[model samples]
Target: MNATAALHLIQAPVALCLDDEINIDLSATDPDGDELVYELTTPLHGANDIDPTAITPPPFTTIVWETGYSETYPIDSEPLFK
Candidate 1:
């Protein structure tokens, strides 16, 4: 799927605090194809809930940390294959 399509798959809250983590789920299928793979592209900085590589700023001292969670699963499809 394209970038626009990928964005649609992710459902993040509009108003999130600095420490809040967003969760997104992406699931796709190809009607006439097989071996579909789901790709989740996020900003390198915003991707990790608490990036150890990130240098905390002074203002971050008062901010609380939150974890973002997401999950994806095959909904309904034809010709169920194991």
Candidate 2:
């Protein structure tokens, strides 16, 4: 038998206000109960040149998955500017 791993977003952000800080929880499950690591990915064709650690503003990075994965996400919205 082949073991597979998959990730599902339990709770996702639907809407947000300007300059809002919200705490979100992302949960994933595996049938085999295998260890999993979470990482924020972008739509890059096939390039690994951009080192996530050396970024200035700090792009979405990887995180070691635990029981509970919760983080406060900040949303910046400028209605007037747009």
Candidate 3:
């Protein structure tokens, strides 16, 4: 029982216009049906650092577990709200 689970991008953004909400979905399943957590990712930064403890590789971003889907989310911007 050494099955490894993997995520597959099912849907992706395409030809989006300005002020359009972005929607993406990644699906995965564990052979043992264990709990899973998803996170949003950011681009890797300076020195191409990939170290987990480098203090510069950037911490894990937002956890998307149990998040609301099938809804249009407004662009989170300070300028837009002001």
Candidate 4:
């Protein structure tokens, strides 16, 4: 059988303050009742080309964010996103 994991009852604040701390919940369930483990890692850069005729094929390459910008702090925000 294929591995299947699903998330339910996700919680998030409707509003976030600029001066706030990081909080997260990764609770999830598997129909097969397999134990779940969550870890944070940099995501892969699937495609970066603009208006390309074709998308790149695997093996996909890693990407880096510009200075002061990242997958988290992608845009300018009050007090910064970090």
Q: Would you list the clashing residue pairs of candidate 3? A: none
Give one digit per residue, the lDDT tens place, for model 4 in 1-82: 8578988776788888886664556677898889888654556676446754557689977677779766666667566645
Deviating ranges (above 4 Å) for candidate 4: 1-3, 13-17, 47-55, 65-82
**What is the C-alpha local distance difference test score of each model?**
0.42, 0.51, 0.54, 0.69
TM-score of every candidate relative to the true structure: 0.28, 0.38, 0.40, 0.47
TM-score of 3: 0.40
Sequence-dependent TM-score of model 4: 0.47
Question: Model 4, 8: alpha-carbon shift in Å?
Answer: 1.6
Q: Can you tell me which runs of candidate 1 are displaced by over 4 Å?
A: 1-10, 38-82
Candidate rank order under lDDT: 4, 3, 2, 1
Per residue, candidate 3 scores C-alpha lDDT tens digits across 42-79 of 33433333665554445644433334421232235434
RMSD of 3: 9.8
Q: Between which residue pairs do clashes occur in model 1?
A: none
Task: Identify the candidate with maximal lDDT.
Answer: 4
RMSD values for the candidates in order, in angstroms, are: 12.9, 12.3, 9.8, 6.0
Clashes of 4: 0
Per-residue lDDT tens digits of candidate 2, residues 1-82?
Answer: 6577765665657897777765566566777887777764333223345764443343555543344332322223344211
In terms of TM-score, which candidate is strongest?
4
Write the residue-wise lDDT of candidate 1 on 13-45 in tens digits.
778666455555556655555566655333233
